[model samples]
Target: MIGAMWKGMSGIYQQDRGIAVESNNLANSSTVGHKKDQITFADLLYTNGGMGHGVGSQSVSKQFQQGQIVGTGVGIDVALEGKGFMVVRSRENPDEIFYTRAGNLVQAKDGFLVNQDDYKMQGLVPQSRLTSSTNPADTMFTDEFARNIVSTNISNSLGRIFNINAKTTDYASSAKNDDIAQKGDNYKSSQSKINDVDALREDYINKLKEYQLTPNVPEISSQAQKSQVDFSSKISSLTSEDNKLSITVGNKTFSVEFDHDGNINQDEMEKLYNFLDDSGREKYGLIDPSSIPTQDDIDNMPITTPEEIQAKADRQSLRDNSINAYSSAKSLVKAMQDLSDKISAYAGYSSSAKSGTLEIEGLIQGKEFKISEVELNNEKINSTNIQEAIKGSGMAMIDSAKEALKQAVEKADAKYLEITNVLDYADLNTIGMTDLNVRLDVLGLADKDVADVEISDDGFIFVKSGDNKFLVGRLSTASFRNEQGLNPAGGNLYSQTDLSGNPFNADTMNTIKGKSLERANVDYGTTLTQIMVYQKAFEANSKSITTSDEFLQTAIGLIK
Candidate 1:
C-alpha cells in the first residue's frame, strides 16, 4: 500500500512537469522565431515482473520545424526561407557569436547594421577590388561575381567576417594615387567649362530677346506738299488732251486714260484697282481687302469733302482710297499714296498717308526693303527722291549669337555625358572593397547624402547615396548538421553545442526573404489539447493516492 502511494506521488510529479511544458508552449505561441518544446515520459526501475515504477518526465527537446513566413513590408526585416540561421556577434564581446531567425534589424547611429540588442550582423566583403581597365579581357565586377565572392569567403567561425558599415568619406587614397588625382582634375576642368558656357548661353539669350523687341524699322517717304491747288482748274489742266497715267506694282501693270471733258475712264480705273488688290493678296497672303478697317469704318460713317465726288468719281471706288484730287499738290500726293499702298501690300510693307506725306515701311522690326522701280507719266523717279534703306545691325547680331549658343550647348552636353561615364566606371571598380570609407573615397562621394539602405533576396547590402548605389557587403548565414541539438538561448537565438557540429555556410537552397519575418511554430490547438490530457492524468494519480490511503485505513481499523 505504501509503495502504491509512492508510485502515485511520482506520477503526480511527472504530470505536473508535463503540464508546465505544454503551458510554456501555449504562452509562446505568438513569439517570433519561437519553437515549441515537447516532453517525453518513461517508466523508472523495472522489476522482475512486468510491472514497473511510476512514470516520470524523461526529456524535453525543441522541435526545429519550419514556421509560417509572413510579409511585414519593412525594408530591414528579413526571413530565412529554408534551413539556416543569420549570424550575429555580441557588440560588447566580439568573440561571442550567436545564430538567429529573427531578422528585425536596425541601422545604428555609428553606421553599422545591428539588431534591437545592438548585436552586429556578420558580413563578407570581396577578396580584392576590381581594376578600372579599358581592355576587353579585364574581369569586371558583376552581380554574379559579387555573389560568388561572398560565398567563397564564408567560414564556420567569424574568422575574417566583419560588421557592415555605411559611413561615407571623400577622396579615398589608393596605391594609384596619381591616376585618381589626374582623373579628379579632369572632372573639375570639365565642370568649370560647363559653367562658363552656361553663362555665355544665358547672355546670348538675353541679347536675342532685346534685339527682337527693338526692331530697325526701315521707312521711305515722298517730300511734303508745297501748297494747295484749285480742284476744277487742276482737273481741267491735267485733262487738257486726255492725259494717260500708267502704274506698275510688282510684275503687274495697269493704265488709266482721262476723257477730253476731264472725266476718267471708270472701266479702266476699276481694272487697275482690281489688279493691285489681287496681286497684293497673292504676294503677301494678306486677309481680304474688304476685311481691312478704314478711317471711315473707325468713324462709323463716310467722310466727304465738297470736291470728293469729282476727285474720287464715285463713293464705291473711294471707300478705301486716301486720294483727293482738289489741287495739283493734292493730286500728286494722292498719286503717291496710291502707289505706296499698292507696293506695300504686294511686298509685305506698311504704308500710310499722313500730314500730306506718303510713307512705306518694312514689316519686320530689324529688316530693310527698297522700292525696285517707280515711274510716273513715262518718266522714272530718281532713287534719291526716296529715303535710303536702314541696315539691320541688330538682326545680324542676333543670328550670329544664336549659332554660337547652339554650339556651346552641344559641347556642354557632350562633356556632361563623358563625365557621367567616367564616374560610372570608377564606381564599378571600387564597389566590392571591404572598407566602406575607402569605397566612398575612391568614388569621390564621401560627402554625399545616403538615400536608402536595402537588403536583397540574395543577401546583398545596397546603399543608395546621392545619384549612385554602392554594393557595401553581403549578409552571412550559417547552418548546423543537427539543428535540433542546438541550445536555445534567450531572445530567439541559438548556440552551437558538441551534439550540433560547428556551423558552416548555409547551402544554396537556403535564401533570404527581405521585408518579411517567420512566425513561431507553436500550435495553439495541439498545446491546449495536451494541457487537458495532463490535467486529467494528474487527477487520476491523486485519486489513486486517496484510494490507497483508504485501503490502509480499512486494514488498520480491522486489526484494531
Candidate 2:
C-alpha cells in the first residue's frame, strides 16, 4: 500500500506538469507567435524479470499549427499569411531576437520600425534604389537649355537693331548726294546737267526747260570762261547716275529697297530707319527675353527719345520682319537644346510633336487589399465603410470578410492547380502575373464579384474558404533539445538543442492555414487525456512493488 501510494504520487506529479502546460496556453491565447505544449509519458520499468519502476512524464512537445491573426487594420498588425514565425525582440531589450507569432509592428519615435516585442525587423531596405534612366543633373541642365534659347534670341534681336543705327549714316550720305545734284551742281545758267536723266529730279528740270521755257544749257563761249564767272558743263558729271537706297521702316519688311531713280525722300527714309530701330528695342525688350536675373529693367527699356517715336511706323515693321527670319531660327535651335536636356534627365518623360507624356512606374507597400468582392456580414469592409457602418448599424459599412475569405481560398486553389499542371513552371510571363494586383478598395466587400479561393506557398496554404476559420492550418510540428542552446541571448525562445541538431522552419506539405489565424493547439482535452495515462502506469508499477513486499512478509511469517 505504501509502494502504491508513492507510485500514485508520481503520477500526480506528471498530471501536474500537464496542468502547467494547459495554464500556459490559456495565459497566452492572445500572445503573438505562441505555441502550445503536449505531454506524453514512458513507463520507467516493464512487467518482466525483476521489480519495475513507476511511470514518468517523458516528452513535452509542441504543435506548430497556424495561429489566427486577427485583422486590426493597423499597419503594425502583421499576420503570417502562410508559414514562419515573426522573429521579434523583447520590449526590454530589443537587441535579442525571439521566434514568435506576434507581428504587431509600429514605427519608433526616431523612425525605425519595431515589432510587438520591439524587435527591429531585418531587411532595412526592401528594394535597392531604383536604377532610373535619368540623372538629377541632367534635369537641371534641360531647364537651363530652355532658358538659353530665349537669351540667344534676345541678343540676336539686339544686334539687328544696332546695325540699323549704324546704317543711318550711310543713308544720310546718299541723300546728300541727291540734294547736291538737284541744286544744279553750281549757282546758274546752262544748268541742264542739274539732275540725272534716270532720276525724278532730272525729269522735273527737263520739263521746266522744254515746255515751261526754264533756262537751257546754252553753249558757253571762250569769253564766258575769261570773265570772272565760270559757266561749265561740270553739272552733268556731278549728276552721273547711281542707284539710291530706300529704307522702308514699318511698311512690311525690315527692308532696304533700292531703285535706279531718286524717287525716295531722304528725310522720310531717315525717319523710317530711326523708327524701325527704336521700335525694335521696345518690342525686343517686351519679348520675354532670357531668364537672366542679371538684366537691368531700366537699361533694356525701349524708346526714350521723341525722334524714335516719330519713326515708329517704320520701326514696327522692321521688328515684325526680324521675328520671322533670324529670330525664328534662333528660337528653334534653343527649343531643341532645351528638349534634349530635359529628355536626358526625366526618365518618365517622352516627347512627340503630338504631345509629350510622362509615365512613372513605382510600387508602394501595405496598401490595403480586400479579400472579397461581395458584401456580407454587418461589418464594414474598408476604412470609409467603417465610419458609416459604425454610425448607422454600429459599423462603417457592409463587412464582406466571409466573401473575402472565400476568394482567398479560391485563389490559392487555382494557383496550386496551375502550378502542379505545369510541373516545372519557371517563366513568369506565361502566367500573366503582371496584373497580379490585389486591391483593398473597400473594407467590407468590393462592388466587383470575386470567387472563393485558396493561396498556397512553399511553407503552407491559406484555407480562406467560406468563413470556416476554426479548422484553418494543417501544420507539421517538431521540437529540439535545449531550445536555449541555439545561441544568442534569449527572448524566451529556445533554438534547436545541441542534442537535437540544426533547427529549420517547415509547414504542412498539403495543408491549409486559417486565412487569418488558428486557435492555439494546446487543448485542455488533450491534457486531461495525458493525466489518465500517467495515473494508470504509475498504479501498475506500485502494485508490482507492493506484491514483492507482500510475498517477502508471508515468507518471514512461515519461517517463524
Q: Give the top-scoring candidate (TM-score).
A: 1
Model 1 accuracy (lDDT, Cα): 0.52
Model 1, poorest ten-residue lDDT window?
415-424
TM-score of decoy 2? 0.34
Candidate 2 weakest ten by summed lDDT: 160-169
lDDT (Cα, tens digit) per residue for candidate 2, span 1-560? 45555565676666667667666667766565566666677767756766545658887676666665464533233455444443444456545434544444454543333554455543211111111111222211111121110000001111110000000011111222213212211111112111111122222222222322212233221100000111111111212133111111112111111122223233433322232234333432323223212223323446568765545544555444443333322222222223322321221111111111111110001012121221112121221111111111100111122112122222222110000000112222221111111111111111222223222222121212122111111122222333423432333244444564543432321222233433444555764565566456546645656775787688789999
lDDT of 2: 0.30
For model 1, how does the per-residue alpha-carbon lDDT over 1-560 read when each residue is reduced to its tens digit?
A: 88789999999999999999999888887777778899999998988897678887788898878888899887777888888888788878777888888888887666677776877777654443423222323232222111110111111122222121111111111111122222211112333334434444454445445544554533222111121111122233454444543444335553444433323233433322343334322322323334434445455543487575444445444433422221223343344444444433332233433323334443222234433344444444433224433333353554344334333333333211100111111121121212222133333323433346667776766655443445556677778899888998878788899999988767354778878888888888888899999999999999999999999999999999
How large is the C-alpha RMSD of every model relative to the true structure? 25.7, 34.4
lDDT of 2 at 413: 23
Alpha-carbon local distance difference test for all models: 0.52, 0.30
